[model samples]
Target: MSLCIENLRAWYGAAQVLHGVNLVIGEGEAVALAGRNGSGRSTLAKAIMGLVRCEGDMRYRDVRLVGLRPYRIARLGIGYVPETRDVFPALTVRENLLLGERKGTRFTTHEAYRLFPALEARAAVKAGLLSGGEQQMLALARTLAGDPSFVVIDEPGEGLAPHVLAQVAACLKTLRERGVAMLLIEERLTIARMLDARVAVMGHGAIRFDGPIEAFARDAQVMREWLFVG
Candidate 1:
């Protein structure tokens, strides 16, 4: 099972952003989408989750997903961790994570706790009171607690201290080992390199570079042309 897209296009109130983007992510594969700001990387991510109006073939595990609502997509074991940390401000850390649990689900917060020890240390604390880094962890943990088969995670390293960033990286690595497919969007090329994922560089609302990360990394001309080296 995997996500397969063909000429995906998106619009925001008549303003088209994504123009015929195509990509793929097989089960347990991690792929990074990178480019300069407004390159349609995030727009493509939102389109996959049906958070915006889109056209073209969007399939997940062989099921068409272009017209599905965001919640419907989520129900199919696809998780979206937006750029914002969508936490219940007044809810305790445990409560926030528990809220993500669905009936008959096998995933639990115990795994989340193992991924970010700080979350376990403050299980009873209000989520709003945690630092930016901890809140990011909570948001991710909460989503993963539902046992998503595929995840689209936007930039999670923004505004975090070095140690906290490392924690996020470790958590992602763990998820990969657990066989969760991932679509990652990040500005830091170094972080993208760490995932050993194929790189899809977006430009002008379309994918301009699609290949192995090493291939993308080695091409100084393409890297600089697409804002990867510069």
Candidate 2:
């Protein structure tokens, strides 16, 4: 497995957000964590990336991830793009992308540009000036700049237009082809459906269901119960 979590638990000032979460993402696999808002989906992402305090057996290819600083985890080949799309407003697009290079993984600028042509055109522009969709591309580009073997992408389609979302979905597919595994949290089903790897349904700080995407689609009861929608 590229990533694994066993009995993961977390809290924010006594407001627990995760409980014994168990999951595994095989190498090069694209898995989605589908759930309603405030269901701990993002929290789980933070926990895996070591952005939040947690107690668990978190492992990335045999390295223990729990208790490590977020940057330390990133150095271990874990790239994280939070829901907020943490781009540097003062930095130009090129500089923003350079932040990801700290991981020391080799990747050509053209390689990232191929995944996001818009970024290529805006390379010299400040990241703060880009539209929401473009900023998302920048955020993802920054993560990919590191040439990470695995990524945790939170809500890539959250505020994007239909066309832009399609582009983002395609970019994710391209990343998967490059053998980069991912744990994707998405509100829209289209991106998850297109990826069509594995699915884990989160609810009330725990995994309500974990299996194939087909299983979630076929069992509407599970969808309605755990996901709160189809």
Query: Candidate 1 on 1-230: residue-level lDDT in tens?
Result: 58999999999999999999988889999999889999998898899899999999989999999999988999999988888878999999999999998766556888788778999999999999999899999998988888898989899788889898888888888888889999999887555677798888899899898899889878887668888543
Kindly give the number of clashing pairs for every candidate.
Answer: 0, 0
Quote each prediction's TM-score.
0.95, 0.95
lDDT of 2 by residue, 14-49 (tens): 788998898989999999998899899999999988
Q: By summed lDDT, which 10 consecutive residues of candidate 2 come out lowest?
A: 102-111
Model 2 score (lDDT): 0.87
lDDT, candidate 1, residue 65?
98
